[model samples]
Target: MTQFASLLLLKTVLLSGLALWLSVVVVNNLTAFRGGVFSVGSMMAMQLFDQAPAISTPLLSRRVTSEGWHRLVYGFVVIVEIVVALLLVYAALASLGAFLGYADATAAIGYANLALAGFVAMGLIMLVGGAWFAYYIRQEGAQITHFALIGLGLAAGLVINIPTP
Candidate 1:
């Protein structure tokens, strides 16, 4: 029973982190749409085209292009997101093992702590990722993405120090 409880807690934390990350991604994309810089379709098109910047009048008129930089930034965001997803998956699996009674309660608690640590780490990464995204967005004349990032970071911190077993 104790093992199951720990597993439940771990699953909750992992799922919550994933949900928060997805929310942040959605909010960021929405902000981009509101800026009129690019629609979802246009963004998809750009991504399809090797994620090159749109050849709009403003961008084309500039001698020094920021397309490469933009691509690099987006690529970094994607990589971080993938890492977070993997961490969450590992947490889920650990939780599953605990719930199945395949692991002792004490060990399950330790696993939970590790999962929480991963979540906290992912949250920090997301915060940094969001800051970078905000910087890039601001350069493109958009608002910051700090709110979601900060909220997630705080939530993750709270979960990380949760009492185990």
Candidate 2:
């Protein structure tokens, strides 16, 4: 089709790919934490939830250990997944804005760049958490897999941020 339509399609594909990747990472991390391993990723993920208590006195009031910690970790994973999904939606809108020429290229780039950064950060968090979970589960075998997924996410984010030719 037209050049604009082609660009729009590329944007859609990138955002959808990002969302799908993040969802897979979240699900796999959770599953491994609950059933497979308790590696470093699991511990790191748990730490994110642990920090919430320090930032908020109310969360601190609630106990955070054992089963409590498990729930907290799971919650954090879910939250991260939700944020990734939202970012993908925003990415689509930003792409549409760009394709329609309703917004400047700079603005479109900014939105995509911001979303990419956010995804990368989230992916890092997921990696750490997944590693910790694997450690806890005593499944050191899965550490490499977790790292691979993180790497994939980072690479995808970087590719999406590249300026269109």
Candidate 3:
């Protein structure tokens, strides 16, 4: 195969890997529903930073202590995860088809654009949610992870959009 074909294959593999990761996330969230909810609830409630000597601010007042709201937010997160996973899976398959000469690059890139957009949207949603609840104060690791995801999604989007020679 030529270099261009190799690049196409690489793009497909990357997209597939991302899709697989998202699938695992959805499965883990569903399988450990209570645990996932607890984690989110803990962040929302600012459990870790409530009395910590670290930067104390009135932002703690924004904490969501209601269990019902926790569950609702967790449900919404899962739904978005599922939707993004499906889009990525479809994009990966289309990319594979393009690589294998069964489809054109335009179709693959179109699906990839949609999938990558979803992926970045997920990252943005997490960033906004975490910021709203002041997760960055004590949950810097999670914030970093979300930023990394957004960066990877943006990089992959650029790769997928590169014109073929």
Candidate 4:
């Protein structure tokens, strides 16, 4: 395969991976995100409120309480995830189509946008939802590592999407 084709394939893989991973996260955390009858979205919200330390010490600095705002934040999170996942999935399919000779160079550029869109949303989740809301602290810094790795993956995909001479 040509270098261009290889790059397209790489972008396809990256976008598809992100899409699949997002779907998995949502499915795995249904109790925390779903709006269904049995869903415990409120519990997840309570968890969010609990993260905010009552007494703001010199170490942790600021704390946020989302008692009544949990569902709203959870909804926002779900919406962002849904939108980004759809974009990634579409981009992956487009990238694959381009790889198979169905599209031109412009499709390659679209892949970068698709990846960036998802990654930017994810960055918001990491920074705003995780760091600002202290999800990392409450969850033992669990998602921090995943967030960094996803950033790296998005960067790699973006780098490869740059046009070559």
Best candidate (score: lDDT): 3
Task: Note each model's CA RMSD in angstroms.
Answer: 8.8, 9.2, 1.2, 4.7
lDDT of 1: 0.48
Better of 1 and 3 by TM-score: 3
Candidate 2 Cα outliers beyond 4 Å, as residue runs: 1-8, 20-65, 133-142
lDDT of candidate 1 over 1-165, digit per residue (tens): 575476466655555566456557645644563332333223323332333553333322223235454455455554555555555555555655655656554554455455445545655664554333332332332213334444654575455445555
For model 3, residues 27-82, the per-residue Cα lDDT tens digits are 99999988988999999999988565756779988889999999999999999999
Candidates' TM-scores? Answer: 0.48, 0.59, 0.96, 0.69
Indicate the TM-score of model 1.
Answer: 0.48
State in Å the error of residue 97, model 2.
2.6
Ranking by lDDT: 3, 4, 2, 1
lDDT per residue (tens digit) for residues 122-165 in model 4: 66565654555454545545466657757765685666466743
Better of 2 and 4 by TM-score: 4
Compare candidates 3 and 4 on TM-score and give the better one.
Answer: 3
- Give me the runs in candidate 4 sitting further than 4 Å from their true place: 31-67, 134-143, 146-150
Where is model 3 poorest over a 10-residue stretch in terms of lDDT?
Answer: 48-57
Q: In angstroms, how far off is 114's CA in candidate 3?
A: 0.6
